[model samples]
Target: MIEYVPVIESPCMSLCVMDEASGWCLGCGRTLDEIARWGQTDQADRDAVMAALPARMERLEGKAL
Candidate 1:
């Protein structure tokens, strides 16, 4: 038997607030475009975007990545 696991995990932290200046979600660290495209994007593209999220979070928080 094989165990099933999700390929991509959503970053939504449930804050659901967008900052006007940066255009990034305060909770998930994803841009509006990214969020909108997430469901349609392929696995590789999704992975690439997910890879950048941590850096986005750092930038939004004014911290060094």
Candidate 2:
């Protein structure tokens, strides 16, 4: 029998711009280290990062206003 493993997709928006002040990617809201280790990270860890993105983006947007 084969075991099923789910794939955790990356959140890259192709913007690839890093905000020097926060150290987060403007497009995906991921830190440099998070982006670097994404492929090697497990599902739970990836999910945790994904969970944090919305708030990060919201904060970034708030800063823009």
Candidate 3:
């Protein structure tokens, strides 16, 4: 019997800088809690976090502009 493991990709860009104001990673747009729990989270949870990343990144970029 073989045990199957789900392989979910990480959003890390190798630039692990955290934005103090938003508490989000500057590169991946994931919160510290989210980043920490990512490997343990299910697909649905990971998807939810990925879905929110674009907006989070947008907001962060807007602040820089």
Q: Using lDDT, give the best candidate's number.
A: 3
Give the CA lDDT, 0 to 100, for residue 59 in model 3: 98
RMSD in Å for model 3: 1.6
Candidate 1 residue pairs that clash: none
- For every candidate in turn, the CA RMSD to the true structure comes to 4.3, 2.6, 1.6
> Candidate 3 residues 2-61, lDDT tens each?
999777799999899999999999999999999999999888999999999999999999
Q: Candidate order by TM-score, highest to lowest? A: 3, 2, 1
The digit string of per-residue lDDT tens for model 1 on 1-65 reads 99996666788898988877888898888889999998878889888988998988888888423
Among all windows of ten consecutive residues in candidate 3, which has the lowest summed lDDT?
Answer: 5-14
The pairs that clash in candidate 2 are none
Q: Which ten residues in a row have the lowest lDDT in candidate 2?
A: 4-13
Better of 2 and 3 by lDDT: 3
Decide which is better by TM-score, 2 or 3. 3
